[model samples]
Target: MAIVVVGGSTRNIGKTSVVAGIIRALPEMRWTAFKITQFGHGVCSANGEPCDCETAEHTIAVSEERDALSGTDSARYLEAGAVKSFWVRTRQGQLAEAMPRIRKELAATENAIVESNSILRFLRPDVYLSVLDPATADFKDSAKLFLDRADGVLLPEGELGRPTWKGVSLRLLEGTPVFAMMPPIYVGPEVVAFVRGRLAAVAADV
Candidate 1:
């Protein structure tokens, strides 16, 4: 099966929209989509809240959408014609515990697209796209850890200027295959073409 991972430097940067756009553009792939959320300290990794009780297993919420109008990320995948959709939640640094279940879900599909950065640690996807916004200064540790592994980067629409963080330059990402993205919308044709071409090439190899 083919796997594509969509990750970003931080939250609310349109990673979900990008995944939806690709699923829509290539409906014939019959993709199984996944959205993974990792929670940090003092939070119930399963529900993204503070909890004192011990849980037996990490929470993995799966939502299958048959209608296109549903508004959740899983719904967006459904709207794009994905065969199945799931949302996986785990404690920070504990994604390894959820992989067996995740793999079972992925094994049941023909092709899959996952929205996560930490998922990269366990699986080497066919394509890894990193979404970034220079205007946003807070970069997640997970994003920094996998920045160099990104096959391509989806940059925000702006002058393409240099970004600095705590005296460190963010210009290193400029060298990668950067696609300028228009925010608050689905991906444009240029980004679409780039993804399609990469997927096509990977398909040819298999």
Candidate 2:
């Protein structure tokens, strides 16, 4: 099964939109989508809110999306045509505790698409696309660590203006394919074609 991962440098840069766009663009993939979230300290992973709970159960929680209209990121995956959608939450630095269940879900899917940079730590996807906004100044360490592994990058439409981020070098993006991201659907035709070609190559090798 082919796997695609969509990751971003920071929040609110349309990573979910990109995943949903790809799912909607290629419905035949019958993608099972995952939205992985790591809650920070003193936050409850179960409900993604501030809490003092330190129980094991509160450290990790995974749930399948059943309501497409729920407006959650995982629910958006279902609304975008994913056959199955899951929301996985884990406390900071504890994603390893949730991998077994995540793996079982992966084993049952024809293809999978996940939204998280941290998952790259355990699995190598057929296609890994990182969404970048040069104008945005915040760059997460996970994104920086995995930037070089990205198969392609999605950038805002137009020339890449000077990046406002500190301690980030454009050299990291060198030799990587860049696709223009037009809003409403961050996955453009070129990005879709690229993902299809990658998956096709994987199927051929199999």
Candidate 3:
């Protein structure tokens, strides 16, 4: 099976959109999609909502998304043609607790796509795409740490412009195949084609 991981520097930059678009664009992959979320203190990982629960026992939750119209990120995966969709939640520093379940889920799928930067800690995907918005300065530390590992990057539409993130040299992005993200879709045919080729190569090797 092939696994594709989509990650980004920060929130609301269309990482979810990119995953959904790939599922829609390549239905034959029969992708099983996962949205992994690690919530901060007092937040519920299962729902990505804030809660007062204070314990490591409540740190991890994984739930399948059944409602395509529910408007949740995992639900959007189903609506976009993923065969199965799941949301995995873990406390900010507790993703390790959820690895066994995550591994089992990926093992059962013919192909899997995960929306997470932290999951990279445990698994190396066949394709890892990072979404970046040069205009957005708030970079997640996890995303920043894994930045150079991306197979390719999806950038917001328009010029490269000045990067506001200090300590993040332009050299970090060097040699990466950067694709322009156009509006609502966020993913283009080129990105899809690159992914397809990567997966196909894996299949061929197998």
Best prediction by lDDT: 2
Q: Write the per-residue lDDT of candidate 1 for residues 79-159, one digit (tens) a residue.
A: 777888886766667788889889998888999999999999999998899888777787877788888888888877733
| Regions of model 1 farther than 4 Å from truth | 41-70, 167-174
List RMSD in Å for every model shown.
3.4, 2.6, 2.4
Over 127-191, each residue of candidate 2 has an lDDT whose tens digit, in order, gives 99999999889888889999999999998893578988888778888889999888875887889
User: Please, what is the whole-model Cα lDDT of each candidate in the order they appear?
Assistant: 0.78, 0.88, 0.87
In angstroms, the error of model 2 at 157 is: 1.0
In the predicted model 2, the residue pairs found to clash are none
Q: Which residue pairs collide, candidate 1?
A: none
Worst 10 residues of 1 by lDDT: 53-62
Q: How does candidate 2 fare on TM-score?
A: 0.92
Sum up the clashes in candidate 3: 0
Candidate 2: stretches off by over 4 Å: 42-56
Q: What's model 3's TM-score?
A: 0.92
Residue 105 alpha-carbon offset, candidate 1, angstroms: 1.2
Per-residue lDDT of model 3, residues 98-195, tens digit only:
99999999889999999999989999899999988889888888888898899999988835689777667668778988898999758788988999
Clash count, one per candidate: 0, 0, 0
- Where model 3 places Cα greater than 4 Å from the true spot, the runs are 43-57
